[model samples]
Target: QQQVRQSPQSLTVWEGGTTVLTCSYEDSTFNYFPWYQQFPGEGPALLISILSVSDKKEDGRFTTFFNKREKKLSLHIIDSQPGDSATYFCAASAGSNNRIFFGDGTQLVVKP
Candidate 1:
């Protein structure tokens, strides 16, 4: 069974602070992991960043960590801003099936 789980259902970060969220998957076959950000008012899902198995990626104020053996993934936001407040989802996918398993999502609130 493929499943993805995110920790800290909700998070509060001050402006200029750092935001951290963790995710774990039960399926080792999952090789592609992507973190998405969603805002209110029926906004479209925004792709924050992506990570590959056994690799770490960072771009601007965002960073991602992936552990293939541990089946874990994480996202960190440097200098959190009020505009960054939104629901973030961690998703994973494997080969062929094209099935994506997404975490419930982590609700983030950045206070100015």
Candidate 2:
């Protein structure tokens, strides 16, 4: 996808609650989608993402949902903790170049 857009500039979730972040892409040619997390004063890191062949992929308390028909994807975090507060970026990549296009990022705040 050439352009990825994420919703809700920022959000706040309570500890042990669930947090959701959404993203939409313009192009369907893109194959790989990834979600990244970044904390203040630190570089973005891979939180939980895969090659994403299936509609849903999950790891621990994190889950990603992809809707091929809607051209949208979302990240769901269950049992959210204060430490989980950070900025998340949704991205897509395609072709042999492996160039990834990222969304503007959503700031998540997990309250204690």
Highest lDDT: give the candidate number. 2
The collision pairs in model 1 are none
Which parts of model 2 are misplaced by more than 4 Å? none
Q: Candidate 1 local accuracy as lDDT?
A: 0.85
Best by TM-score: 2
Report the lDDT tens digits of candidate 2 across residue range 1-112: 3499998889999999999999988887877889999999999998876564779999999999988889899999999999999999998877567688899999999989
Models 1 onward score TM values of: 0.90, 0.93
Clashes of each: 0, 0
- lDDT value for model 2: 0.89
- State the TM-score for model 2: 0.93
* lDDT (tens digit, per residue) of candidate 1 on 1-112: 5399998999998999999999999876777888988899765374655646347888789989887778888999999999989999999888569677889999999999
